[model samples]
Target: MNLFPINAGNLKLDGGAMFGVVPKSLWQKTNPADANNMIDIATRCLLIEDGNRLILIDNGMGDKQSEKFFSYYHLWGNHTLDGSLKAHGFHRDDITDVFLTHLHFDHCGGSVQWNTNKTGYEPAFKNAHFWSNKDHWLWATQPNRREKASFLKENIIPLEESGQLKFTSLPENDLQNNSELGFDIFFASGHTDKQMIPLVKYKGKTIAFMADLLPTAGHLPLPYIMGYDTRPLLTLNEKEKFLNLAADNNYYLFLEHDANNEIITVKKTEKGVRLDTVYTTEEIFN
Candidate 1:
């Protein structure tokens, strides 16, 4: 199987919110903020070419939101979903599956787009079967007040409306086993309900897409949780346990929101499991 690093693009977010209660002095060293306190973040996606299926995981934020909406996130960079796909000698039509870790705009925003008529939304990948967990799908669509802003209806409704939305079955007691979850249904409730982090076996390596669970190397530290997470304590516990298993098993973690570091290795230490090494997607996948 071949793995492709799909860099959708970059956007800016408040560092304080991203780091939650972590002090600026600590987080700033890893992900330094700009004068406005906004930090650049990458909506990094992954393309999995296995057997006859060309699957894409999380299609970054698409260019459909209003100018005022886009301004809030401070979108930047030359990277784009279409451009990135073309760079890898592929196009949107070739994607057979779009495995969304969650329905957050930054993660699944690129899944739908405005039709040429500009009249209504359409599935960005017309031929692809969009994937999400049933529980998370319910949570996102019926979002609570705290997460309503992150789950935009425009980026969503259309997927189901297009008749392309599908849910991956949640394996029973799978999250308990580091090697469980027959097809990788990682139940990380802290970031969101049953966030589906796809585990791809590529080139004899276990490549697990680490969504908001371990967004960046800086978040490798146990307490460095995101303010956006609905349940901060759940995230802390989930991260610690997952990092320990990741370090023990030597798994490669793909960062979806990390603008700088791409892939990283975790190692156990006195301070707790920490980033032992970092690698760009090319270095590991290529």
Candidate 2:
């Protein structure tokens, strides 16, 4: 199996929103904010090439949205999803599966795109089976008022409408030792309902795709939760449990949102689990 870090794109988000109630004074030390108080954010998706199956985890926000719509997020960067795939000698059509950690626009928006005619929306990866758990699918489709803005219809409905959507079976508990996708899934609901965090095995190490559950190295602290999370208290509990497990097992965390830190490991310190070492995708994957 080969792992590739696919850079869909990069954007800037409000540091306050990203770090929740955590004071900027502390967060800025790690994720320094710009004059506008926006911090760098990356839509760093993962590509799993195992045999003939080319699985992509979380495509970034596609270019289909209007300029006015995108202005809110302050999208920037030269990394296009198609360009990234081409760099790896692949294309969207070659993707057999698109494993979405969640349906948030930044995470799964690129799953669908505008058709050539510009008449309607269609699955971005026409040949790929888009993956999302049943619970998350429902939660996103029928989004609550708080999360409604993040779950855009154009970014989501087309996958199901195109008949390419598939749901992963949830485990009885939060952690699924084995999933149909051939990896362990850590189901976290604090960020959003049933956000599936895939634990991929590679190079004798487990790489946990730290989606919104742990957006960046700065978020390693238990209290540094995202304000966007529906249940902040529940997030604290979930992060404590997951961080301890990651530290104990020496898992390499593949960060999805951190623009600067690509991969990292944690150690159990007196202050609880803290960042141990940071690594680029090249350092680890190569």
Candidate 3:
């Protein structure tokens, strides 16, 4: 199996929101904020090429939203999803599966796009089967007031409308071994209900798609949860368990929202599991 890091785009978000109650004095050391208190974020998707099945995990926020809608996020970057796919000698149409970690606008928005006539929305990848679990599908479709803004109908409804939506089998516990997508899935709910974190076996190592469970290296600290998470206490427990597992097993965390750090490894330190080493995509994938 071959894997590639797909750069969808970059944007900036309020550091306070990203790091929750963590003081700026602390988070800023690792994720330094700009003058506007906005920290850099990347929609880094992952592409898995295993024979005929080309699976894409979380295809960034698409370009369909209005300028006014995007302005709030302060989008900035040259890395278009199309350009990144082409750079790796592929296209959206080549994707067979779109494994969404969650239905947040940034993670799954690129799954659907405006049709040619611009009359209505349609599946962006004509040939790909969009993947989400029953729990997450229900949570996103019937979003609570706290997460309503992040779960946009335009970004989600079209996949089901196109008759290409599929659901992975939900795990009895938090972790599902060897899912339909051929990888273990770590189900996390603190960030959002049933956010599936893919644990992929690549090149003799486990590469975890650290969705919002661990957005950036700065979030390694257990208490450094995102303010967006609905259940911050649950997140603390989940992160503690997962981080210890990752550290003990020596997993390479593939960070999706970290613009600066691509992949990171954590070790069991005296304080706790702290960042051990950082690696660029080239260093690992190549």
Candidate 4:
């Protein structure tokens, strides 16, 4: 099995929204904001090459949205989904599975693209099966008022329309065991309903894809939850349990939104679970 870090572009988001109630005095040190108070974030995706399957976990925000739409997020950087794939000697057509941690635009937007004729949309990964659990699929499709903005129809509906959408057959509360994709999925609800965090066993270490649950190493503390979460209180409880489990097992956390830090390890400290060491994929795997 081979794992690759795919750079899917970068964007800026309000630091206040990203850090929730955590004071700017605290989060700003780790993720220093610019004059507009927006911090740089990476739409970092993961690529898994195992035997016949090449699976991509979260393809990042795509370029299909209008300039006005992207302006809100302050999109920046030259990294793109297609360009990143080509850099690794691969292409969108080579992906056999797209394991979405959740249906948020930044995570799944790249899953679909505008067709050649520009008449309609189509699955971006022509040969891939897009993965989302039944609960998350339902939650995203029938989104509540709070999360409605994040779940865009243009980024989602096309996958189902193209007949490439598939749901993990796991039970609602199941947070253990691997899905058919060969990675154990932990269901987290605090961030959004049934956000599946893949626990991948690779090269004698467990790599947890920290999709929004733990956006960056700065978010390691229990109270550093995102304000965008539908249920902030629920997030606290879920994060506590997950971080402890991660620290106890010595898991390598693959961060999705962190621009500077790629992978992080946590250890139980007097204050709580804290960042232990940082590593590049090459540094850790080598």
Candidate 5:
């Protein structure tokens, strides 16, 4: 199997929200904020090519939202889903599976696009099967007030409408060892309901796709959790468990929302699990 880092684009979000209750003085050192108090965020996705199946994990926010809607998030950078795929000698249509960690706009928005004639939306990857767990699929489509804004209907409905939506039927306990679409799946609920984190085995290493559970190196410290999470206390417990396992097993964490740091490995330290080394995707995958 071959892996590639697909950088969809960069966005700017409030540093306070991203860092939660962590004081600015601490987090600012690693993820410094701009004059507007916003920090750079990357919608970095992953491409897994095994056999004839090309799987894309989270396609990032697509370019279909209104200008006013986009102004709120402050999208930046020249990186795009199509451009990034082309850079790696692939195209959107080549993706055979789109494994969405969750259906948040930044994560799955690129799964659908405006159809020709601009009358309606359609699956962005016409030939790909869009994957989301049943629980997350329902949670996103019938979103609660707390997460409604993040789960845009336009980004999700098209998958089911296009007859390409498929749900994973793993039992709760089976998540840890279950492999699907060429990845070992693990589920976490702190960030969102049934968020599937994929563990891909490549090059004699277990690479954990740290989707929201541990957004960046700065979040390695137990208390540095995102404010956007619905249940912060649950997140704390989940992070503790996952980080300990990651450090103990020497898993390389592939960060999705961290703009600067690409891949990080954690080590058990006097201060608990902390970052050991950081590497770009090329350094690790290439």
Candidate 6:
């Protein structure tokens, strides 16, 4: 199997919110925030090429949102979904699966887009089966007030309309338990309901797509949970358990939002599980 890093784009978000409860004095060293308190984040996605199936995990925030809405996030950088795919000698039509970690705009927004001439909306990966669990699909389609803003209808409905929306259910734990998809999925509810984290076996190493579970390497500490989570307390428990499991198994965590650190390995520390080693995907695999 072959893997490629697909950088959808970069966007700025408030550092305080991204590193919930953690103050500027601590996180600023790593993710230096601007005067307005916003920090640059990478909407990094992953590409899996296993024979004919080319699966893309998370497409990053798309360009469909209005100017006013986008002004808040301040999307930056030249790395786009198309450019990233083309870098690997591929295209949107070449993708066969859009494996969503969840339906948040930053993660799956690039799954759909506006057609040319502003005619209507359509699936960005025209040939891909956009995958989301049944529960996650229901939660995102019928979002609560806390997460309503992140789940835009334009991004969510078009996949189903395109007849490419398929749920990653049935076998339930499709990744870990079923030995399907070349990874085991670990479910976490603290960030959002039914957030799927793929534990992929690539090359000879076990790598995990740490969606929002640990957005950045700076968030390695258990207490560094994001405030945007619906349940902050629940996040603490989720992170502790997941991080412990990651450490015990020696899993390589691929950070989606971390602009600096691509992949990180953590070891148990007295200060509550500090980052043991930091490296790139190439180093980990090679």
Q: What lDDT score belongs to each candidate, Candidate 1 first?
A: 0.86, 0.93, 0.94, 0.91, 0.91, 0.86
RMSD of 3: 0.7
- lDDT, candidate 2, 1-286, per-residue tens: 9999999999999999999988999999999999999999999999999988999999999889999988988888799899999999998999999999999999998998878999999898988999898888999999999999999999988888888989888889989976468899999999999998999999899999999999999999999999999999999999999999999999999999999999999999899999999999999999
TM-scores, each model vs. reference = 0.96, 0.98, 0.99, 0.97, 0.98, 0.95
Q: Please give, for residues 46-145, the per-residue lDDT of candidate 5 as tens digits.
A: 9999999999999999998899988998988899999999999999989999999999999998988898989999998988999988888889989999
User: Which pairs of residues collide in model 3?
Assistant: none
> Global lDDT for candidate 1?
0.86
**How many residue pairs clash in each candidate at the backbone level?**
0, 0, 0, 0, 0, 3
TM-score of model 1 (CA atoms): 0.96
lDDT winner, 3 or 5: 3
Tell me the lDDT of model 5 at 22: 94
Give the worst 10-residue stretch by lDDT in candidate 6.
Answer: 170-179
* Candidate 1 lDDT, 155-212, residue by residue in tens: 9999998889887777575362223222455678888888876666666777879989
Residue 171's lDDT within candidate 3 is 90
lDDT for 114 in candidate 2 is 79
List all candidate RMSDs to the true structure.
2.1, 0.8, 0.7, 1.1, 1.1, 1.7
lDDT of 4 by residue, 95-213 (tens): 99999999999999998888999899999899999999888899999999999999999988988888889988765464767648998888888899999899889989999999989
Off by over 4 Å in 2: none
| Candidate 6 stretches greater than 4 Å from native | 170-180
Residue 143 C-alpha lDDT in model 2: 97
Model 3 per-residue lDDT tens digits across residues 1-286: 9999999999999999999999999999999999999999999999999989999999999999999989999999799899999999998999999999999999988998888999999999999999998999999999999999999999988888899999999998989985478999999999999999999998899999999999999999999999999999999999999999999999999999999999999999889999999999889888
Sorted by lDDT, highest first, which candidate order results? 3, 2, 4, 5, 6, 1
Residue 183, model 4, lDDT: 86
